[model samples]
Target: MPFRAQPLRLVPVLAALLCTAPAAAQMDHAPARCTAPAGLPAPMASWRNPLALKAGADRKAAARAILTPGRTVTLALLPTPKVAYPVRPAKPGDSVSHGGLASFTVKEAGTWRVALGSGAWVDVISDGQAATSIAHGHGPDCTGIRKMVDYDLKPGRYTLQIAANGEDSLTLLVTRLP
Candidate 1:
């Protein structure tokens, strides 16, 4: 006779497992901004990310919290990014005024979102890749952040550039537990 699984005994186990994701894919629980200083680029054609810290959490204790809509976390986006910059400013949006940038540290590897809020275009640079970008005349927020793009980030900083077209007035809030 084949062994049968017990559903009743597996409810808690399933819940626990479902409650946590992998390290690299766990950024889904990290904060919005980094643990470094925040910044705002001068409206130009190109730009570089700043924040140079890791996810808001360290390994072992707690996982880094990912930025989710309606759940804001405190963090930073250093204008002095880890990568080299040609001094190229970011693509200013249409209505970005009183704007700036914010970064989030990586506690562990996990999926996360740098969802750009109200602006012409928000550019997200992770691990030196311009992965997620919100185009012009588009909404400020961008979801469906891909894996390896915003998750399982190395113990380092990630940049989220939120700006508008004319005068950057976009507000970036960094949210994280702890």
Candidate 2:
């Protein structure tokens, strides 16, 4: 009689291979938006995001968090932003106030580093409060340097409002030290 194949023996091998897959390769998740506001744009055409910095956890942490560093956050601003802060005197192609909004969630509470490419301005809003870094002359990356902002944040949801100085594209990156 010819040798018969043992189909049952292969089940264990297949199971072992499936279980050993990396966590990242097992699932595909979407990266949180970094250029657009969280839910809806607050249903306001001229709403400027608020900026605030606090020492510890607060009421804002109650909301769910949603951003992951695995994906890249890149976006283009509208021809004319609904809200513009006009940080300086308006120049041609410079609205100052026109900016895009992005929302993210903080999985762990810690000091987070937020870096913006092309010297874009950012307004951090939490619990309806806002705060910004004050610079009299120009942004950290205004002169072709990357701008970085650091803040102590609690685990919660956050809205990042950003506007390009003059360019049409902006890149926002967020990370925390291991």
User: What lDDT would candidate 2 get against the real structure?
Assistant: 0.47
State the TM-score for model 1.
0.32
On the 0 to 100 scale, the lDDT of residue 160 in model 2 is: 62
Count of steric clashes across candidates, in order: 66, 14
Q: Write the per-residue lDDT of candidate 1 for residues 1-178, one digit (tens) a residue.
A: 3345577678899888777757536687554554543342222101122222222212111124233322333233222232132122375422223223444565654444333334323445465565442222221112211111122234466555443323322223332212
CA RMSD, predictions in order: 18.4, 17.4
lDDT of 2 by residue, 118-168 (tens): 566665667666644333222231222256666677787776655544655
Worst 10 residues of 1 by lDDT: 140-149
lDDT (CA) for every model shown?
A: 0.36, 0.47
TM-score of each: 0.32, 0.47
Instruction: Output candidate 1 Cα RMSD.
Output: 18.4
Q: Candidate 1, which segments miss by more than 4 Å at Cα?
A: 1-90, 94-98, 126-129, 132-154, 165-178
